[model samples]
Structure formats: structure tokens, C-alpha cells
Target: MPSLLSSAIAHPARNQHLLLLQSSVAQTCLPVLRDVVQRSMERAREKTILFCLLYPPLSFLDKASRAQTDRLLVVDRTTYVPGYSDGLDFNDDVASFLRSAIMDSIQSSSLNIVIDSVDTLLSDINSVSATTRILSELLSIVRTRGGTSRLIIHVLAPCPLLPILTQTRFSPSLTHLIAHPTALLTHIASAYLTLPPPLSPPEKFWGVFIPISERHYESEKLVYGSAGEGSGLQDFVVEILVRGGADATGRRRGVERELEGWSPALGGPCEVRELDSLKSLCSEKPATEMQIVPDPTQNLPFNLNLTQEQAKSRAQVPLPYAHEGKPPVQASMPAAILYDPDSADDLDDDDPDEDLDI
Candidate 1:
């Protein structure tokens, strides 16, 4: 069976991933992420672009290193979002900057974007709101782009480095896993992958949990529905809870097998269309085949289109600023400038002070 990393990279849009790694951010997390991109590039028939924007100057890549294996193009962060030391280095409007970068990349090739080490961005005591808005907007990029090739978003290794999240025993992993650690994060985030919890099972299998629910927004927060066996967490644990047998539906659940000393660099590639996801990548939809913008009113319940009668009605709806009926209120042509010659006024054009100015 393929690893969670395989499933994640293969998945199309609507996957705003949160990867929580037990290993160090620079060491294990980064290599694993790079390998995912490399594998994707190798498997893909054409070009793929990776937008990896990070912070703290913890990078080994540069402008010259843009093209890796067959054709994996990495849009170096320094080139896109200005500022070097700060991760993403975006001002208050992180969304606008990120969207601008993503839009630019969409023109290049099939896009895969990464908000690497979000821990660095959320380090400040007051960046919570900005960070949330950034995440919320990033998840919505696919919908707003209105293209068949809207970029895939990946958020890797978020919690361990954040001070608030790392304080408690379970908070770091649970913070990344369960809800309300951050309201907008859980609401917009589609998938959560924790790479080997620090406290591991004795037998040692790489545990991967990804929960996807039909998104329901109430009070502007995401609420997840029952996926397979209750919540995604509960579903992932079903293997440990009830020793195996197919359910009444007889749908075979993914049987967890022990992995022997796994390293991403050594792992072979897995096929893409293995998971049960909304975005299907059964076969690659090449750029030539993809439509630029899909119909805006695709899945909306309310009608945005107007009937002929309705269009006429809308045309009749007088705009307040349109000045529909009021005649042009011309200001009486500046009331005929009457300087009716002040009795003592001199009309001389020549400078009166010329004689005194010598």
C-alpha cells in the first residue's frame, strides 16, 4: 500500500493539507515534502510547478535550482513574495500576495503550492488573525480561480514550533489534529496528516490519518461530517478498535501494515488515483484539454442569471447615484461675476509699485 504522502500529492484541488511531523522541520519534514514533489514530477506526463514560500532563511534552494527532476519547477519564494528573513514576509495582506503568486504560476503549468512551516508565520503573539485570514483565503483560491487547473495547496508541519501549541503533552499533535486550536484553520482545512507521533505504537507503523467531510459552514466555521467510521480520527482508529472484518457494506477498509524503517528518499512512487476523493485524477487532464474558467454558477442554489422580464426589471431599478430623474443642477453659471467697478478701484494693468521698486 502507498503512504499518506503518496495520497496527498496525488490529490487534486480542495485539499488544504496540514502536515504535522514528529521529526524536525528542516530535516525530515522538508526532505519528505521535496520528495513528494519530485515523485509527482516524475509521475506526471508534463510540467508541474511548486510554489514553496518559507521563512527564517532556512533554505538550500535558489533561483538556479528552479528545475529539478524531469520538470519540477519550484517558484523560489524570494522571487515571488519580497522579504528574505521573514517566512512569506507578506504584510497585512497575505492573501493578496499569495493569490498574485498563485495566479502567476497558473500561467506556467499545472500548479502545486506549499505554505511551508506555517509555524514561522504564526510566531508573533498577535499574528493569529492575519494567519487565519491567510489560511482561509488560500483554501478558497481554487474556487475563486475558476479554472480546471487551480493549484493544489499544502501546509506542512505547523504546530511543534508554535509556543502555545507545544506547551502541553497532547496539544501539539491534537492542536494540529482536532478542532478549535484555531477557528479558521480547522474550518477551511480539508486534510490533516500527522507523521509518526512522538509517542508511537510498540510495533511501529507509520500512522496516517486524513479526514475529509462535506463542508458545512455555520457561524463561518467548518463542521465535519461522518466520513467512513464516524469522524476521520475515529475512522483511522477503527483498525485498532475493532479487529478486522468487512462491514455490512462489505467495502474493504485500508488495512494498516507495518512499515520497516521508512525514508522518503528511498520510497518508490505510488499511483495517484487510489483514494476516495472528490477531485478525480484517474487520468491526467493535460493543459490543452483544461478549460480556463468554469461556469460561475456551477453549484449555486440561487440563480444569478436574470430572465428577460427580470433583466428589464433590473434595468428599471434606478440606481441612487445614477441621477435618474433630477435635471442637471447647474449652479446658475457662477452668478455673472459682478465686480460692478468699486468707485475708487484703479484698472491700470501696469505695476503701480514699478516706480517705487528701483
Candidate 2:
């Protein structure tokens, strides 16, 4: 049986490289990224590490709720460490420890890391030079592990680093950890999901996140060169809601909050035109005659207007007389008119001739 990650990965032979990012790191590009986590959760591999970069603490909650991995370990600079008794430790040393702990956790459980906000982490790194060094070391440690653990770093920075991530490689403990970008990366990810557009028109696009291959191990790459087919793509819809720092246990309450705000599914029934139309179904009134208002918008079978003679003749016609009334009463309309002329020819001509003579 194929692993969950293998199944989630479509066409591993053609394209290789997975670049998974939070649909939104900031408020601007949410619609595109909101469903990213949900879809990612459905299509996640057991040994995959989802690195998330979020700005607000609440945002972290949302991301965590949507995509659950084997182990969820949060690393935040803003929060205090519980065990540190000395008036809450807040130093780079603690951050380093947390990073190492994360790597250790990964080793125990296939080494999957969810960095909530890489952009934020980069920003918080006291020294870009030293911080990068620390990250390099951690990534190196992760790569050296015997287990084939995949690392997904979600970087929120959009301007330069975002585009250059593929070409860029920092020295890792193991040289192969240098990440590269590919078509599979772009195909698996939807750029539209991260676009900061108006909320009214909810049009979204799908993009695939392919894994960056190691320079030496070509065959070890999950996806190859062809760019996998589109049959494996999944569609998702996402909405964001303001969670007021609630102690909610599950992801649903957060979703409910979002639904309450957006109300995406509020258009009501298509055929129901007026409140009165809905009243019939809701109230269940036993009406003797339900007046059907002619929908001018709809195509109707019967003509609305009729001449006086036509109205009188139609009024004289009995309802389904062919089925209800006596069987041989008489042939209807055209049949009566079409009857043999010889049957009525006995008396009419003689009376007409007498009138002409007078």
C-alpha cells in the first residue's frame, strides 16, 4: 500500500518537489490560502513537516486546527516557556533549544515540523547571519536523520525571497538539504489563493506545490521532470473569521465564526420568488386553491389573452369529458365538424332553394 504522502502526491514520476505555504500569512492573501491548509491536511503524508508562518497568535490557531500532523509543536518568540522558573526565560538560547527539541521530535515521529510563520521567524531571528546559521544547522540535523522526513517551510515574505527560494541554498549539516524550486511546486499551489482581492467575487485558482530535489540524488526526488497531470488536483473553499482569543478545543468553532461573518451560503432557494411562495412550505397551510402567479419570466404553455368567442367555446368545453362523461356521447370538435356531409345533406339544400324563390 502506498503511504499517505505518496497518495497525496500526484504523478511522482514527472515532477519532484513540494512547496506548501499557508494560503495567507497576512490578511491580504487569505481567500487563496485559506483552503490551502484544509486541502493540505486531506492530502498530507504521514512523515511530512508543515512549516507555517503566521503573524498573529490567533492565526496560528486557525492553521493548526486546519492541518493536523503526527505532532503539533508551536514555537513562538512572544510566549513564555513554562518550565523556566527564572521570571520567564526570553532569549535566543531558549529559541535554539526549541528548534533542537523540534528536530528531536521529528526524529521520534518521522521529523515533520510545522513552522507557523517562516517570515515571522526570519524577522525575529536576532541576527540574520547567526539565525540563518542556526536554521542551517537545524535543517542539516533534519536531513541527516535516517528516516525519510519531509520538511515544509511556509515563508510569508512575498517580495524577493519568495521568488528566489528555489535557486537559494544555505549550507546545511548535510549538503543535500539545500531546497530547490520546480514546476511541481507551482502546479500544486494556487497563486490565486494568496491574492489580496475583494471578497465579493469568490473566484479561486489551484496551484500544486512540488518538492525541490537534491542536487546529488536525482532518483530520490519524489517528482520528476514532466510536471504531473491535473487529475489529482483537489478543489477547496475557505473563509476566515475573527477568533476573539477563545479557549476553543476543536477547529469547528473557528469555522463557525468565519461562516457567521462571511455567510457564503445565504442565497436561499432558486425557484422561490417571494415570501408567500416560501410560506406554503414553511406554514403548511391547507389551501383549497393555490393561486399560481404567472411568472412572466418563465415560458408558459397557454396564451394569456383569448377572444370572446374563443373564451365562450372553451368555457363550454367540459374538463376531461373524454374520460369522465358517458363513453359514446358524441365525437369532439373537429370530429363532429368532419362527420360525413351526406348525413346532414337530407334537408339543408331544399330550404335554401325555397328562400331564394320567395
Candidate 3:
């Protein structure tokens, strides 16, 4: 049987690379991130590990059993005051500390670095270009190491920058710096994974994973993808992870009771006693009489200028067709009379000689 890590990754024992995971809701994806980190730790037993958490505190890391490993180095930069912490200040060289830490980690033995939320880093820097530059440098360092070192970046899905990038047509320079930050990371990363919002119960969520440069066979495709003949390309694969009930220790006694009588051998065959009773009750009731109401508009006075007899005669007569044998007769044109301007002036003089005095 394949392990969880083997199933998720194309090759578990690969070189240094980047993996990005994104989701709309943070809570829904935290578990998935934890799962990946746990799996990574299992694979890289002697490797140096670094966790840079931006959203949750050190206590949240305990949930993922990070406390068990002494090799795990955690940088709790989740809390920062605008004026108090000079090194953690967001406005001035915000990512300088983070960059330094990542650089130090890459220099050590085969390293595994996990940045909890890249969205928080971008928010603090407040400059897309600067934040992107910082991330690019960090990724470059990891790739340069080219060993078991890997970088996992978690970001929120449907990133706020996506809409601005898509709606507004910006210049090439601005577009490169500002638009769809997650999309930019996706292109940079060796593999990308996205977590959709959780269902109503919040126990399960869907994840899509795509390996950038790796070629996968049709048999290696996900359950749904395995059905059709694949193009032998690195296709995006989807997996659903179901988290057991919050209280795993407590057995559901009520559910067990409900299932007790569900066995056919013990309860006998199923019968529809209610169906016959319902039919008997319905037969006792008399059929209802439906009354048709006359239209109110029927008595309305619509005064068209035709009598009942004239309307009947008009309705009986068929309309004449232009295509019938009876051709339409054209009216004769009257002869045009020619009038000279000089003759008209003489006629006007005769008519108005008495009326107008020269």
C-alpha cells in the first residue's frame, strides 16, 4: 500500500523545490497543512526543519505534534506592534528578518521550511513588488541548495489580488509586480495544491495537486482521472481528506442504538403497514368538487364600432390574397396642365388691379 506522502507527491525522495497550498477559508486548510508537515517530518527524519508561522501561534503548532521534535525551529512572528517591535515592524524592511531566517536555514543540512501564511507576509510588507522579490529570493536559495530541502507556502485562495489583476488592464511592469500573487507563486513552485472550502459539517475538504515538471502515467492519475486515456501530461489531481469526528475518544452510543434494529436477520423483512392504513383513510374521505369562476373581463364594455351582425358577417368573409387570380386595378393618372409665369402674373394683375393702387 502507498503511503500518504507517496500518494500526494510524484516522488517522495526528490530534490529541493517549492510547494504552494491555497484556500479561501484558513481554518479549512490548516489541518491539510498540518498533515503535509507531519508527512514531511516522517520522511526527513534527520533533516533540519524550520517553521515560520504568520497566522497561528506556537501553541497551534503543538496540534501537529511539532513539540515531539527538538530539531523543529519555530519563528513565532504572528504578533507585532506598529511601534513596539522595531525588528518586526511592518512598514520598514518588513520581511528582512524572515529573509535572514530563511537564508540561514538553507545553509544548514538538508532543510524543510514551512511558511504558514504568505498572505500575512504580503500584507505586512504592503508592497507587492517587495514582497514578491523577497519570496523569489527565498525560493532561489532553496532551489540553489538542490537537496532534500523544500519550501511549503500556505496562502488564502481566491486571493484579493486576483480580481484587481483580472479586472484592470495594467502595464507589463505593474502587472508583473501586483496581479494574482498566488498565480505568480504557482508558476514559480515545482508543485501547487489548492484546498476548497469545507462542507457544512467541516469534517472534509477537497484538494487539487499539480506537479509542474514531473510526468505521470495514466495509472498514476487520481481516481476520477484514471478512467479516461490521459495525454501523458502532468495533470492536476484531486483528493478528498475526511477528518474524523472532533472527539474521537467518545463512541456514538445513540448511532449504535439506531443501527441495532437495522439488521434484516434480527428485524425480519421490511413491511409497508402505514401505506395500507393511509390508503384506507384516503378512501373514506369524499372527493372534493372544484368550482370554475367566470372571468370578470368577459362582462367588461369593450366598445368596438361594429354591431353583432356586422362582426358575424366580417368573421364569415375570407380575407383576399394578393397572389389570387384577381389582379389589383391601378387608378388612372390625370393630365398635367402647363402654366407660364408671365400668364400667371397677368391673371394676378386682373384679379387684384382694383385692390392694389400703383
Backbone-clash count (model 2): 36
lDDT at 87, model 1: 50
Residue by residue across 1-358, what tens digits does model 2's lDDT show? 4321222222121111222333321112232233333343343332333333354334534665634434444444444334543343324443554565565454463444444445555555444555455555545554554343334445543423343333335421110111122222222233323221222222331111112111213312323434432211122212222221112232221211111111113321111112231223224334654565567845768778789999999999978643464355455634433233566566554555665756
- Number of backbone-clashing residue pairs for each candidate, in the order shown: 1, 36, 1
- Residue 161 CA error for candidate 2 (Å)? 3.4
Model 1, CA-based lDDT: 0.37
TM-score of 3: 0.39
> Which candidate has the top score in lDDT?
3
Which regions of candidate 1 fall more than 4 Å away from where they truly are?
1-3, 10-27, 40-110, 124-126, 143-261, 268-358
| Tens-digit lDDT track of model 3 for 268-357 | 111111122122321323334235566665755784468889989999997775446744444675555444466445554365557777
Better of 2 and 3 by lDDT: 3
Q: Each prediction's Cα RMSD?
A: 26.7, 19.9, 21.6
Q: Which sections of candidate 2 miss by over 4 Å?
A: 1-70, 78-109, 168-358
Ranking the candidates on TM-score from highest down gives 3, 1, 2
lDDT of each: 0.37, 0.34, 0.40
Candidate 1 C-alpha error for residue 40, in Å: 4.4
